[model samples]
Target chain A: EDKVVQSPLSLVVHEGDTVTLNCSYEVTNFRSLLWYKQEKKAPTFLFMLTSSGIEKKSGRLSSILDKKELFSILNITATQTGDSAIYLCAVELFDNNAGNMLTFGGGTRLMVKP
Target chain B: DAGVTQSPTHLIKTRGQHVTLRCSPISGHKSVSWYQQVLGQGPQFIFQYYEKEERGRGNFPDRFSARQFPNYSSELNVNALLLGDSALYLCASSFGAAGVYNSPLHFGNGTRLTVT
Candidate 1:
């Protein structure tokens, strides 16, 4: 079965700390991996990594995909209290030539305290 | 431009009852998808519709159904609601359902459903 797993289900860190979240997937026809940040209600898009070894960065948040290992990692530097949210990793599966469907990991919750 | 919009920001339904959730896709978007996010878990895909056609469905049961209108709006219906059915229903829309490069979905705040 196609699935995505994220480790360190929950983490707590002081402000300005750097944290790494991992996501590994076993799916057929892996297309792209996306990361989302959820505060309370809906999730907001962060980064979509399509290629391996290439890092996509946006401010203090960045992510990279390792296709060979069927995994990805999201890194947050200089973490602030605003960064305390659920970080989700999902893998896009293009099955049966159908359109893109994302299978998401259980998400890692980060709490950054000042 | 308005992002995806879903009706009844909050809802409460009893068990064995049926409920319908509405969603209007972002302007000019052709694809709409539904996801269910239970407490403390990731959002799970329920259905994806494009151009008023059913493009894909998740592992959800037949009791869960959805449809898209010609105007690119969509609705998700759940029958025989169970306590387990309580979750935040999210609606997302994208301009196209083609390749990875073209399909970037924007999500709405979602409707919170509480089953009694």
Candidate 2:
């Protein structure tokens, strides 16, 4: 079975603080890793990482994947109150018979205080 | 353009009852997927449909069935619901087939089902 695990299930940080979330996966035929932020009901897309070493960034948020190590990390340079949400990590896998599917981690709940 | 849209933001059911959830994919999107998310847990993949064909399915039981229409809309039906079936059901859509690289899914707000 494909599995994705996230570390530090929950975190509390203040404004301007930087935080890093970790995700590791064990699967066959790795296709890509994606990050999302859920505030209320829907989860918004953040980044999709496919290659190792190269980091994908958007404003204060950034992520990097290490295929060899089977892990990825999402970094928030300066957090704000609005940044409080559940951070989700999902791994996409492709199988010749099963086609493609995504498996998600439990997610890390982040509470950013103003 | 509207994103993925699901019907009945909330629902209440009892054991042995049947429920049908509806989803309309984004305009021009050809792929739609369904997921179930329990409180405090990650969403679990239930089914994926593209071009009106079943592409992939998770480990859910036969009681959980789904079908896609020619317009790319989809419906998920669960029969004989149990207490454990209560969860948030999410619908996601993508422009291309799920296997396509770099394709990200756009999710709907989700339907919260509470089985009493």
Candidate 3:
């Protein structure tokens, strides 16, 4: 079955500590990988990585995908209390008859203590 | 502009019952997708509708069904609801059915369904 697995299911770090979240996937019809941050409500989009080696970054959050390795990593630097949330990784794949869809990992819940 | 909107933010139902959740996508977005997110897990795709057509569906059973209106708004209905059906039902909108390639989905806060 097509699936994505994320490591360090949960973590607690004091402010200013850097953390890295990992995700590995196995699926057919690979297209892209996306990262999201979920706080209390719905998830908000973070980064979408298509090609390998090229890193996508925004402020203190950055991500890169290694297609050959079938994995992706999300890094958060100089973390603040606001950074606490569930970091989710999702793989987008083309479905022959169903167009495209996303298979998501279990997510990494990070708590940034201030 | 307002983000995706879902109605009946919180719902309570019992086993074997039926319930319907509603969603209004962002203006101009033509595609809407549904997801089921249980506690401590990521959201799982349930269905995708565009132009009132079913474009994709996940591993959910027939008990789960959804339809999109001409305005691009959608509704999700669950029949013979089981306890396992309790979850946060999320609605996301994008420009088209193929947006999974590039478009980032704008998600609504979601409806919390409690099955007892």
Candidate 4:
């Protein structure tokens, strides 16, 4: 069965502190992995990593995929209160569903205190 | 683009009742997928449709069903709703179906359903 797992279910850190979140997955025909920031109702896209291109960055946030180890990590540098939210990792497989079918991890709840 | 849109931001229903949640994908997007998210948990895939055809389905029960229209709009219907069925339903859209591995899914705000 395909599954995605995240480490450190929850974390609390003071603002400006750096944090690292982890995700690992086991799936067939793994095509890509995606990261999302869900502050409230909907999740906003953060990055999509593939075997050929395993790293992505945006501002203070960055992510890397290790397909050989079947894991990925998201790093937040100089975190702010606005960065407090659930960080989700999902893996997509080659399927008849446009790769839209994703297996998501439980997610890591990040709390940044000011 | 307006992004994905879902109806009834919030809803209240009782066990054994039925509920229908609606969604409209972004213009030109041909794929739509539904997900159920319980509080404190990541969203779970329920169904996926493209060009009015059922493309994929998750590990949900038969009581949970959905259909996509020619216009790329979709509706998720849950029958005999149980207390456990209460959750937020999320709608996501993509530009294509099958083999479009790089297409990212754009999501709607989601519909929160509370079953009493």
Work out the TM-score per prediction. Answer: 0.96, 0.98, 0.97, 0.94
lDDT of 3 by residue, B1-116 (tens): 99999999999999999999999999999999998999999999999888889988888899999999999999999999999999999999998663455677888999999999
TM-score of chain B of each: 0.96, 0.97, 0.96, 0.96
Report the Cα lDDT for residue A42, model 1. 74
Candidate 2 interface RMSD (Å): 1.6
Off by over 4 Å in 2: A96-98
Give the least accurate 10-residue stretch of model 2 chain B, judged by summed lDDT: B95-104
Question: Which stretches of candidate 3 lie above 4 Å from their native place?
Answer: B98-101
Error at B22, model 4, angstroms: 0.5
Give, for candidate 1 chain B, the lowest lDDT window spanning 10 residues. Answer: B97-106
lDDT per residue, candidate 2, B1-116, as tens digits?
88899998999999999999999999999999999999999999899998999998888989999999999999999999999999999999998865357688889999999999
lDDT of every predicted structure (CA atoms): 0.89, 0.92, 0.91, 0.89
CAPRI grade, predicted model 2: medium
TM-score, cand. 3 vs. native: 0.97
lDDT of 3 by residue, A1-114 (tens): 889999999999999999999999999989889998999988999998999999989999999999999999999999999999999998888776556788889999999898
lDDT for A4 in candidate 3 is: 98
Better of 2 and 4 by TM-score: 2
Error of 4 at B10 (Å): 0.6
Enumerate the candidates' DockQ scores in order: 0.57, 0.68, 0.67, 0.52
Question: In candidate 3, which residue pairs get closer than 3 Å at backbone N, Cα or C atoms, i.e. clash?
Answer: none
* lDDT for each residue of candidate 2 in A1-110, tens digit (9 for 90 to 100): 78999988999999999999999999998999999999999888999888899999999999999999999999998899999999999998875544687889999999
